[model samples]
Target: MAEIIEDFLVKKDQGYYCAYGDFYIDPLYPVQQAVVSHAHGDHASPGHQAIYCTEATAAFMQIRYAKQALSSYQVKDFEQKFHLNGVDILFYPAGHILGSAQILMIYQGVRYLYTGDYKLQEDNTCEPIKIVEADVLITETTFADPNVKHPDPKEEILKLAVASNIMLGCYSLGKAQRITALLNQYLPEKEILVHHSMLAFHRIYDKFNEVPMKYELYNRKSMKGDEKNKVYLIPPLTFNSYRRAKNVLRVFASGWARLQASNDLSLYLSDHVDWEDILTFVKQVKPRAIWTLHGDGRQLHAHLSDDLIIRDIFTQTYRPDFC
Candidate 1:
């Protein structure tokens, strides 16, 4: 058998390290060279000596971290191949956010694909996912359980039809932009308002969007009058900070059940792939072995056949002959 994934890349205290490439993928803390998958805080950190990612990911990182974003960087387009210490690498769309990408690294003639965070659902706010085959498939099993089936986003967004005024709590980066676009497409009659923190992300998304999202900044005046049919989009921090308001329904847009517990209405919108999507993606990739990360993989492990090895990076130690 070909060399197991451990020889090519393995998880470390800092992040996933590729010894051949001499870089870290989505490191926990800043490192000398970081191959970022996206601009999400957990995936990308500042103060790196050098960085690599797509153009949009870099833009979002700059907007989020400002001057401290990085000391040096290189941006690449989707499917564009480059080399890192002789390790051939390229990016493919992950479809999770504006610049989210699946990093593909080839070393010793074996292909390894690292899915930072990905989704298969149609998201007008960001680029769509592109599938590529690899010998080893490393994936984030965020919603890998068979029972977790995310509802259609269109139907979930339409749940707001009955409410004249809605206060929607969502993440500032990707979620806000997605919900804003959905509201425009599905609930055009309602006036959409956005929180200040998400403006920068929205501006960055607008550059790549064919149809610019329609929204107004959240202001006290916008909430003052009995503004019927108004939807105020606010980040989770602001949403949690707010007090109960009269006649306004509180809703949160997320796939996590915990986040929806306190909401008056539930909107099961998410940017990660569900179990079915994961299986579909796997079939497309046809990897010789599979390694899971980011979430529980027991369900995925039990579901796959013996021909394909499923290793959970967090739960089990890696060995050359493990596969």
Candidate 2:
């Protein structure tokens, strides 16, 4: 019989360590060689000696990190299998954002996959989720609770029409670009204004030809009382601190609305797999074993036991003999 990947894996302070490939997956801090899952701040950071990821993710990294801070990068196209330390690694589209990926690792005859902040729902801005069947499936359980389910994003986007001039609170990166594209697609007649900080990423998105939309760098002169179908997109962190007029309605876009309360209307527009979608993905992949990442996955562990063996990666140590 051929050799197989072990039933156990290692957990270090940096991230999940892959012994067969001699690499780390989405290291929390700087490392010698890291396999990045995406360009999102929590999953990706600068100062790796060498980085391996999809081409689109590499482009996003260039936009986020200055060249001087990033040491080296190896760009891989989606579905391209590459060899590192005699181990096979593959990248599959993860649909969380523009360049997100679900990493698949194969050692000998056994396989494992890591879903890095993924969503199965449709988005107008980026690639859709690509499913990969593996012996072990590790997922980001951001919204794993049974009660949490995201409404259609276009329905949420349509809510902007209620206020003549609306102010949207979104993160400058993924959430901001997603909403911007949604607004353009669903409500093209509305005028879209964006914060200066988000303008740079818009150019990056434009360069990639992803989410092409018209937007103006925010200016007070653009403020008009006529306010029929006008929208302002700003970083939530910045918008909360600014001194703005009371006339415009404020709205927040996030999945955490189910758990937390926010001022004004909360639009459940998330890029992560919700509870229902998470279950659907598990059934689609049909993995022999499952592990949770991203958020506290107690609910998922409790609920998904009937489908597959739920393993806890954080508490596991490396083992070689058993597969």
Candidate 3:
């Protein structure tokens, strides 16, 4: 019998190693030629010698990697097709981050789509997710359990802002921007306080003219414990620490929050597509074979069509030990 998976491949007289969505040189396995779907550390490694990504991903990578050698790598834009050896590849917005992409590879006569984490909901800070049909689909199964269903991002944000004295703690980047924009739309007069990390990303968002609210950025030191009727944006890790703040309610925005693990009343926001959304996307793409990555792949695999041949490959930076 053939190996369930092959690590190395010989194509056009060149040897390459495949690990999930990443590819590298043979013996050296230097991770030289990389097609990154997003700037997330799990997907885009700093160790790669050459990188192909969207312009927005390139910018975020510059901040994350912080080295001229890494910055020297090439960056590509969405929908731009390029040929490496004989394989043709293209990038499409994944709707995960400002520069996130879903890589489409055309090798021989087959088309393979590797979805880096994606969301179907519309976010004001970045391009909307584009649905593309493919022969084989490699997608993230982060919230693939049947019981998981997210409230519309816009509605969740508005509800959180209106119900709480302080809306606090979420991912500093993409999710925060989405929340802030929704807050601006529904609670225009409210004050917003963001963590330093969020402020940095917010600055970048503003640079791109993506910020929806005219708000001030604040740090922990600046917070005077007077957070009444204010929305405080913070990193997920900071949620427990700020739980004691007076008149402050802690809320986390992420796809994972839909699970029972997030039973806390403060956490109700999610920017990712839930189980229902995942099924919808899969049904729409209608791929013959589907590979799951990120989140609970096993749960997702159970729900997919038996004919769709499911394979699990862990590609989440947030949970590196998953594989």
- Top candidate when judged by lDDT against the true structure: 1
Instruction: Please provide the root mean square deviation of candidate 1 (C-alpha atoms, Å).
Output: 3.4
- Per-residue lDDT, model 1, residue 295, is 89
List model 1 lDDT by residue over 124-151, tens digit each.
Answer: 9999999999999999999998889999
lDDT for predicted candidate 1 compared with the true structure: 0.87
**Taking the tens digit of each residue's C-alpha lDDT, what string does model 3 give over 176-288?**
77677777877786777787777766666777654545667776544555445677677867766665666555556655544225424434566567888888898888787
- The candidate with the higher TM-score, 1 or 3, is 1
Candidate 1: stretches off by over 4 Å: 69-71, 314-323
Global lDDT scores for all candidate models = 0.87, 0.79, 0.66
In candidate 1, which residue pairs clash?
none
**Model 3, runs deviating above 4 Å:** 1-30, 68-71, 162-167, 209-212, 219-222, 225-227, 257-264, 313-323
Stretches > 4 Å off in candidate 2: 1-9, 68-71, 224-228, 243-245, 258-260, 315-323
Error of 1 at 38 (Å): 0.6
Clashes of 3: 0
lDDT of 2 at 41: 83
- By TM-score rank, best first, the candidates go 1, 2, 3
